[model samples]
Target: MTGFVELARAAQAARQARPQVPLALATLVQVDGSSYRQPGARMLVDAEGRVLAGAISGGCLEGDVAARAAEVCASGRAARLMYDLRADLETIWGFGAKCDGIAHLLLEPLTDWRWMAQAEAVRGRRLGGAVVTLLDSHGGGATCALLDGDPSPAKWHVLHDDARLLSLPELLPLAHSTMRTGHALLHTVADEMTVFIEPLVPAIALHCVGASRGAEAIARIAHTMGWQVTILDHRPALLDELDLPEGVMRRRVRQLEAVHSALAELPHDARSAVVLLSHIFDVDSAWMTATLPLPLGYVGVLGSRKRAGQLVEHAEGVLAARGTPLTARLRHKLYAPIGLDLGGESPASIALAAIAEIEAVMHARPAGFLRERQSPIHSRTPSPRVLERDQAPTLPEVPLRCELPEHPAE
Candidate 1:
């Protein structure tokens, strides 16, 4: 979502700088089997044929899309370009496409204020919304509308391409569905309008439940990736000592029970994760007991397989003592010994492995090597939790700052 917003901002700026030069946005709206880029991926092009912001494919389709975008800018109309790489062994556009897939791109000249409005929507809006582009308009001539789903009508001021409002109350119902499915749908509304509704949700949140060394790595990397990270710990001393990157929220709690209310109050969805990195049995046990009931996207504990089983037993014991029954859902959602087998003993490698697990879960992807997976290298449907254009927040990547402590000298 942020990436699209950035493109919007860039588009607006480019338009402002040259006022006369036209710019167009080509969005990869739909994809068939074996696409390098999935639906919701975007690429921006200008009248001068320069690619900006996003890419629709791995250097295979951008040239053609950019040419189409140049045509859209020159013609001042919206257009859709369909590419079928699997059609034949050789053809124009470089003697057969490499992806062996099909993609539908909605290319529209960004001449109106709607792009700027989307940029603003990405700025502060959090409730999640969608932009319903009337692709049938065939480019600049068609209408684009934005309906922010988070707030009521007061905050969600609709904008149309022609500077006049169109009564699209029917879109309100679709907004709910878009947010739920986290995918843009090409729907035929009243008056035979074909609008692509793309949902915009909040960034993924990772609530780290300890200030251990592993916790620092998680916070730093997740923060760099634009995830909303909240470092929660009972020990103020340890929490303060953690050198997390900017945008990481630090919460100081006084007891194990404090986490319950904290977790309850957090704004989370299926993309959120709660990772236990306290490294202490009592602390981890208390957190697991408290977290197992919450409907988080992931509940991970850092430990060995045997330790993971033991922790589950401890959590069940703790919950049973309180007469709380652990649900099967907890078993399904929890990733004990959190993270993938990246096989690095260093702190940074461990952190990478842990985040990789969360990423896989968020995308409903199995954690395995690409060579081992027979399916396409890129998954077509991202995690339903991810909104259109919602990449990491706009922040510089954080450098690896963690220095693992040396083992005791012989």
Candidate 2:
């Protein structure tokens, strides 16, 4: 079972044990600045406003969410809360504390079995789709099904004032977290006024190709991040050495044929990320040869530049013979010299950098040092905007001074 499945099960158990208590489910539907949970991150809050499962933010924000959850449970109404740390004193006092960047949370009282049933059904099918429509917002309610389909709406449920037709092709590639605003429309897709369709699938996956020290660290880090980690290695000794948890799957294979066979058996999805950290170049070559062409979220390989280049060259020839053109984007996605520029030689440090790079790639971000970059450390801008309307101003270049400020002569 996945981490989410376990969380659901635990929440169910808690609910059963305390039948009298009402449960409020709070999910971090979207994040604007640096926050702990990403989009679709969920946490179960009991009637007493206690956390039963999941994390929505770092320790700084959970207490406030829990308190609000109590109020939500007391009243049967759903609340769309935006937590911003940069708010003025009045807003901060009203919202409890400022979180700096905005974190949009959907807190709904879980009194109906139907909502839980829908979640359970999605979990059983392992299908990823979002329920888009604001419960309290101004937009009309309409659910968009995101399963692989033609550019047409499939099933229509409850109708509201603002009906908008959206082609699935136009919506899939765009980030799912963003929403637009507009009036009701029936024909063409609108760029504005659409509630985001949030998928139920976890946006993180751990793909381990070799059971080396690096692989072990990767698995551990991914587990902490609530990702589903799958370990595939040819050496039984490597698996035995790691002493991984029961949740992690260990696949034993000798050749690329075995690896391909194993991957073919499993269902491939956008949320999955594949990492090949095997010391054996042949095994790495075989895995890369099989995975690179597939539409994977992220593919990382552990090796030096020279070694990765050689493997890629061989793989390209192999793929070319099969009539599959290896693109440049796919090549860059396959990090031969895996990990960020952390200048680490140790296996553990290398693993940290590799996992960091994987997360950065998953989020479509640059894996650079935050201190070195001039941009806001945590803020994300969806669109560029002019800061001022006037002409561009130039400042005189100032010389750097190493000495301390001199005392003024009084």
Candidate 3:
């Protein structure tokens, strides 16, 4: 979800900078085996075959995908490109991609920028939604639509060139299920049409309740991970002195009494995370007490076990006096001693551990080695049913050396 947001922002910036440059979008709709990126990953390609942002593969597949995208931009037609890298990749395809996988991508020209506009509308809205694309079985046509709002027929809106796919009643349930589960899915109706539903969720919001050295480190690390980061401190001087990444937000929180109001201005959804690392006991305590009742996903306090216990005990007393006891639900959300058990005393190492822990908690995963796991590394959604070979027609073959005409100026 966060990756899609970054791609959306990049595509938007590129369009704004050069509106006359024709562009195409390639979406990885399916992958069957070991791969660098999973389904729903995207890359934007211009007429000159430059990758603006995002990536569908590590580095081996972008060149070919960009070449195909140029043809899409010239013809204004959607095409499906399949790469079978399961065996003897160097001998068969000469690409030397050691990854034993099969990848399917959908490339379409950006004839109208309505899809981009809809994506920008919900980029940071804190609302979960889905993008549904209907594709031809023969790879001749494609239409894209956006689904946002409650699970009601009247509220679900579809935008695209084709109105026939938009009126399909069966797509609503599939799109709703994908959004609810936060998973991407590919579904085929008989052998005529295939639907790809990609979930869109807001990026993780990290509240660094400090402007200390540790806070700066955490902000930089989280920003690299595509998380929304904000550094809050009681002293404006400390905040000014702190160096942060380009997109990191900073707030001067003046008084401990105004902690609630300060937090009110930030995100309060279940995707939100907070770390009380101010090092000032009174300020951390105040923020901790205020955040207990909110809908935050993770809350961490940076200190030793003894200090963490003391801080929580004080918060428990304060909440108890207000006739609201600290329940197990609230206690489970607090991570004292704030990080995974990665052994390091430096601020940078500590920041890495803390970010790792928060990511695990937010995704409901156990922080353990992948080699020890029994299941696949990536989560599995419902698999696409196999279409009959006779019924599934192949896409038109475009020569590798086909010359694409330059995009004419508007």
Candidate 4:
């Protein structure tokens, strides 16, 4: 969703800016065993077979996808492309590459309105579910149904004719599960009917308090990764002189004494995060004093362990006076000395390490060296390879349409 968001916007702009041109879309719905990209990654192609946005593989499969997209564009029909990147000495696709995966991709002519709606929904932070679903029409039973709005188990805004998919008792549970756990699944409703579920929960929000060198780095990296970014400072003079990046929202607040006041300004909920980088213990405590009581994805202070403890003690005093003792869960979630140990004294390096920690905490993943993990570098599932052969199981017949992940393409 992150990769597709920017690309979709670019493609839409290009198409509207130059209506004479035609464009196409490609999305990797499933990847088996050691794929360069994961499921839900997307790309955009033009009539001339140009790469507009996103890349499925590092460089192994874009050319093929682009070529196929061109053919699909000419024919005005969607296509399912297969790329077996298994390292075989016989095939050029595996040439000198540590490839051993099969990629299932959907190629279709670009739809501008749909792409814009999708990107905007993702960027707008109005949605909740992270899993992205691609309803495949490859199984012959094709339908026009596609859900693109803020999806909840209770309701789904189907974009096309009545898919009636929500009526399935079995599917509702699966949908609920996917919402809880951001997992990708390809389910076969019938012979030739499949649905790829790849929940792309919108990027998490990161609020950087008190702009500084480290704050700048955090904002930049967080923005590039498609995280909703807000840089807040009570002091206008200091924040005014700071050269923040273009996308990072710079906000001026009178004070951080009341969380509601700040939240009212932003109107963010638990999915949002707040990091204290003021380097001033009193300021950080004020932010944490208000932030700790609420449910946020992450709350951290950019300082040493001792500083964190000091702020914690101070925040506790403030909270205790207000008749609310900070709970154990909140304490556990707070990182006093925020960020992983990347061992760099520079502001950028520290910022990188810190944001990494924040993100890990947000996703509830352990922060550790990737090499240290026994599983694959990108472990959505331990056995994605097995998915290729024993694909979706047979189910009752139902009309389907391969709903690829949308881009703004906001």
Candidate 5:
């Protein structure tokens, strides 16, 4: 199953285990002007008021949501929250927010586990699917359906819709929009039309090799960034000593063989990033050489540039002899001497750089000083033209006169 579906299933299972528990489902209903999260983004909140599935906003909005979730859990009622980052100076300052847009969050109580179960069933089918919910319409409720068969140009059926029945052709376009939050499809058949859409779950995963302090820091930051983190280390003692979040998975594996086995088990997708900080040169080298050929989102090596060059050379020689072609694309994907140019020697700083670089690569952005780029720092507004044609002065031509004062001066 996909990560999003698994998260939904997990949250559903958690709620099922404790029927009395109240769950709040926070979804991004609208994105006006500009915002961190787009429409249809969702985060599941547990009865304890803890975020179980996704992130609504950054840290700025989570705390308030947690508090409000507690209240909803206690009251067993749904609530709608609208956070406008551009409200007042005091309001923005109080929330520690600076976004110039508005985000609408629907914190609904998950009192019905049956709907969740049905959603899980649809997800388990492994087919392209969508969940359509009518927030304020003639048919007001959430319904999920699976798109049977491979996604093609043709449309498919949406499993559950009691208010209005839709054919395959009518629902396919809606499925695509359902990948984002609050996106809907208005289908016109005969004289009537129905709107169907839902939010998409974000795809992100974190892989940490070695239980070094740097790895711990990366895991912590990645967790906050809404990544499913898995920590693999040779030393069991190191794993035991580390303080990691509950979401992070720790695996005890020794030697390069174990590393290869672990990587082979992961789902190869663009949403996954792997970081190697094994300290041991031979182990790190071996893992890199073996895994370089595999399709992965990002692969980072923790070491000096000199050491990384040596390792790359060794891998190239070995792979060449084995008749495996190691191309430039593969080499570039291998981030040796990982992280941005933070210029800090400490583990924490190194960790920061590593995570930053990973994020940069994942987002297809360059890891450098923002001021150096011609692109806008945050928003994508077109740069204003300083010298427009109408604004430029059309000076009249003037003949130059040469003065013969040299003889007189002499």
Candidate 6:
């Protein structure tokens, strides 16, 4: 989400500036092995070989991709650039990086700005969506980005429409699967043309229920990571006194009665997380009880193990009285002694540990050292290889139109 945001902001600025230098969009369509970035990663480059925004690799492939972008802009045609990173690390062409993989990128001229508008529109909705890109053949480099409830009847907004690509009945199913599973898929249509289906989910939102120094620390770190941060407190003075970044939001609510309404107005999706740092027993208790029934992914309380247990017990009694049961699923969402066991007593160290834990839990990963893990650092599910038509299961049909727009000959 952060990568895409950077790319979008840069591209939008470039468009508004109306630069004389032509621009190109580099989409990392596929990866054959372990790499710093996965498929669906993108970078925007200019005719002068400057990287405007985003990154395809950890500085290894950007230089080469930027050079290719110059050619793509000049020719006015999309070019498929492939890099074999499995060579010697010390070689001059290797960029001294140890990325032993194959990266395939689709470099296209950024003549059509409608795709940019569509991307911004979908993002503004704060919902999940899938982007389908035609990678080589059948209007290669055409992209269709639509949100969950787009009003436009046409499913795709691209350079031009291609009849052959539209005839492929399996395209829509593959895209639906990508959105449902929240995983990117590199697919081959009829064993000839290639397409990439990538999912776009909203950024993680961190809700700080207190305006203390600890909350300020967490908000600073979260803002740097591009997560939405909101600081809330019953006392408006504390919120005003706390120094926070520009985009961070501040809200003041009256005690228990307003807690429910305040939380209801904020993000309540699985991507949202709430942390109780008020240090006030009654305040934390009221917030905990209010958040239990919501669909938030993580709910952390800053206190000792004993205090956490006591809050849960109190929440249970309150919920039982209101005829709402504290189910196991809801209990699993609570992290009583908030944050990871990073061995820290200071507010700064404690904030670091909490943010790290939230990231791990949100991704459903075990918070442990990379050296101790045996499996790949990133999950390589749905194989990067060309998915066979019969091999990939057909997900249920959806309203999405996966038509590939034809890239008109220059």
Best by TM-score: 6
- Estimate every model's Cα lDDT from 0 to 1: 0.70, 0.61, 0.78, 0.68, 0.62, 0.77
lDDT per residue as tens, model 6, 1-410: 36656776777677677568888888888888888898888888888888989888888778778887777788888888777777634463734566678888888888654555456456546665666677656345555444333222245443334323533246545655666566788877653766677777667889999899999999999999988899999999999999899899999987778998998789888889999999888999999999988999999999999999999999999999999889999999999899999998999999999999999999999999999999988767873433353233444434334443543332
Candidate that would win on lDDT: 3
- Go through the candidates in order and give the clash count of each: 7, 7, 0, 19, 4, 1
Candidate 1 differs from the real structure by a C-alpha RMSD in angstroms, to one decimal, of 11.5
Which stretch of 10 consecutive residues in model 1 shows the poorest summed lDDT?
399-408
Total backbone clashes of candidate 6, pairs 3 or more residues apart or in separate chains: 1
1-410, model 3: which lDDT tens digit per residue? 24655565666677789887788888888888878888888887887788887899877788778877767888888899888766545754575756778888888886654455455456477776677677776785454666555343444454555424444345556655676677788887544777787877678899999899999999999999889999998899999998888989999988888898988989988889999998889999999999988989999999999999999999999999988789999999999989999998899999999999999999899999999988777757574333342121232332112112232232
Residue 406 in candidate 3, Cα distance off native in Å: 28
Higher-lDDT candidate of 4 and 6: 6
Native-to-model Cα distance after best TM-score fit, residue 296 in candidate 1, in Å: 0.7
TM-score of each predicted structure versus truth: 0.78, 0.70, 0.85, 0.83, 0.63, 0.87
lDDT of 6: 0.77
Cα lDDT of model 4 by residue, 195-314, tens digit = 665554556788888878788888888887788888888888877777766777888877655545876666356567888998876778888888887777788788888878888998
Pairs of residues clashing in candidate 6: 160-406
Question: Candidate 5 — what's its lDDT?
Answer: 0.62
Worst 10 residues of 5 by lDDT: 401-410
Full candidate order by lDDT, most accurate first: 3, 6, 1, 4, 5, 2
Q: How displaced is residue 18 in candidate 5, in Å? A: 12
Q: Give candidate 1 regions above 4 Å deviation.
A: 12-20, 68-71, 86-97, 112-126, 137-143, 150-157, 161-173, 190-192, 235-243, 369-410
